[model samples]
Target: MFWVLLLLLAWAVAGAACTRLCLAAARAAAVGDTGAGIGSGRDLTLYEAAFLSGGPRRVADVTLVAMARQRRLLLAHTGWATVVDPRGRDEMERSVIGAIGPEGQSPIAPVRAAAATADAVRGIADRLVRAGLAVPDGAGTTIADAVRQVRLAVPVVAGLGAVALLMPAPAEMPRHLIAMWFALPLTLTLSCLAMARFEVHPYSRWASPAGQRLLGALPRHTDGAADDRTYLTCVAVRGIRAVGEPDLRAAFAHRERYLGQDDGR
Candidate 1:
């Protein structure tokens, strides 16, 4: 029984990790193939879909709402940010990132939260186009389509997670060894997601609030669209708006400085 308990714990952790890896793989696979001559935008769309996956239906929606809100935030800033923590609403108010707020609320309290990401997308696209760092119609629409698919895929991922948790552990080494069944496709998917996430711009959900703030994933900010100034380049792989050259070398330099100084990191 003790060994079984240990096995169960091991299974749970391993399963969860594998599941995350698998999900990521699926996303990467759908994102695009670098060697296939796919456009940057098409590649990104594949990535966007990979990111929309998550938990129970409601959880998935909340995650999406967060993503949408973040994208919107990039559009405009309303100041303070609000969140529904495990505590209550009272635990929400203070904007100091640690201040106090309304308390004693039920689980999953519905509240309005502003998005800082949407505005970011809009802002970067507009600026990058002006700076000539990008090429136009460069998969913008494709990226949007990918975002939609990713949002749709979220629930499916959540369901899969729950099921994986309940799945019985393999009984023998042979089962594990012969289990190349789901691995190949999964590996391929992951490779694709990696390609999409890095090679493509605008499609990287990791650039969004939903992906970053909630999912704890970090943006690369080191790929094709990685212009620091003009906010044209996102720390993600998604899209490329048309560019015309505005000479932003100094601005890019400053932006890089700010990123380095952020949180004193």
Candidate 2:
């Protein structure tokens, strides 16, 4: 019957989505990261730590905070960033300066955005990927996309089942029987989602398991009296919110508000 056709479609949709998600998760889980690359023996640099903890954006954040602290850049509480030194100490600093443009001043929000996508940041990501500490660019996205597809399929399957139930049924085949058939696909999708939550959901978009281990091994920096290394390490790992200075925190908050306003436009 036509309802049987709809039931078949439902099964196809649910099966394809769940299979794709499970395969993607399995593939991701298979590609293991071992400590055999450039970063094996050495402690993670601030940039590396930043990338592993929060990706390219965190690298830009830490660089901006470091330069601002050293008086090489001015991060005002009103969201503007002024370059005090034209010469950058490194490529990351140079990227931030370049992002600010020739006028030597720009909003911190745009500066952070441009710096995060700059070649310096890309290079950091490349190195981390090569070192087996970071997820490959689109590798993590595969799992995420598959999960989304499966989630979408759940409602689609339910809708198909509802439509089938509304249509004519055979003389002997009961309406509840058709519902039970639909319920099979629903159960499949739901069970897969639950399993994914435990098995594959810990998959980080930036750091691999090896990278996570390294991050966990780093000493925690929580005190206000920490040295520059400790303080910057904290900022790199935990982002701008970890900044102990009230002014620095205020500057970033202003940047966030400015971003919201800019996005509305």
Candidate 3:
């Protein structure tokens, strides 16, 4: 029957996607296993924490915020960044300055884009991966992308099933039977998504389970903290929205709207 062929196609799509996701998850778990005792009692640097919490772009955000706070860089509410101090205190700050260009002034958006992909950020990512605290590039389903694929598959299977039901079905086989056949793939996708939710919800795009544990152990700071270190730490782990200063937060908020960046969740 034509419906039978469609059902087979549905199963193929669901099986391939779900299998890939499961394999990725398994590989990620294996990485976690091998990372045992790594980074134990070792504190995360602001850059490391930024990468683990939100990847390279976040690292750029942290560096910009830190420099701006220290008055080494000027972040205008109009999304422009001006270099105040020619000398960078660290590699990260230097990267941002370089991204701002030889003129020492640039739009915050382009600078952020450039700085995020800079070698400094890559180095941080590499170190985190080596330490088993972050996922490697193209880690397949081990990253949040895999879960997203599975999520997409669910709706695809449902739509395909609906299409198949509208097609001609053998009288003896029955439309109900055809629908049941389609349900298998849908069920498979749903089951996988459910498992991922329960087992590894809010799947980190950057950190592995071992890394996540360390991140969880980091001290949480409230908005009232006066120390720049504590304040920057919160921004590093939590993002720009965590900035307590209205001027500082407004600066980032303006940048986000201009560049379509997230609120640093």
Candidate 4:
């Protein structure tokens, strides 16, 4: 039982660690932006990581509504005016869709407008944190299941490091203890890199797909409860530099920044 638990823990820690490194790297590569349009039928190419991690990966299809295509269709129909979007109405607010387009579907409209798409794209990133897919910052279990899994893995990771030190290690660098010491750190570092790499490509693909499918799947409204948890966790993790420290400041500050950038702010 002890050994069994240990192995499971090791696997969990490895999984959690991998999850963090990937998300962090993806966020960094994206310059703090988690682009939109994931799981939308319009763009399916960004499914790389979705495919790689399969269903177990938190950021993929699970949080998205299966009938999400209909939602976009509604946005398009109700606001066909502003919906005359080159990339569809992705950037425009759904409420104002008509005024923005009504009929400007002039074939000459530019195919993509990144700035216009900013609101929708950022909204998705903020929401993912809400759904418990991303880390919650500091120590709280933002994604309870994932966090618990990661916590379990921590000891396992430590155990592996300890065990590896006492065992015969590869001779490529050196033999015995010294090799194990160097090898452990290097392995950990590479694992971190591998995890981060996982966060980038697929999400970005969602933001830039042809049908704008990735951009389309985002819920028009942000998730408030999830947003609160995300804000508290991020501030706790970010410490003094946290955007908003308390309720009032957090409410206004976060709202002004990203969709739910507020919370504990």
- Best candidate (score: lDDT): 3
For model 2, residues 91-136, the per-residue Cα lDDT tens digits are 9999999999999999898898899899998998888777777777
Q: What's the lDDT for residue 98 in model 1? A: 29
lDDT of 2 at 147: 83
Better of 2 and 3 by lDDT: 3
Candidate that beats the other on TM-score, 3 or 4, i.e. the better one:
3
Model 2 clash pairs? none
Total clashing residue pairs per candidate? 42, 0, 0, 18
* Poorest 10 consecutive residues by lDDT, candidate 4: 58-67
Off by over 4 Å in 3: 219-221, 253-265
TM-score of model 3 vs. true structure: 0.90
Predictions in order: lDDT: 0.30, 0.82, 0.82, 0.33
Best by TM-score: 3
Off by over 4 Å in 2: 33-42, 138-140, 162-171, 218-228, 243-247, 253-265
Sort by TM-score, best first: 3, 2, 1, 4
1 or 4, greater by TM-score:
1
For model 1 the TM-score comes to 0.24
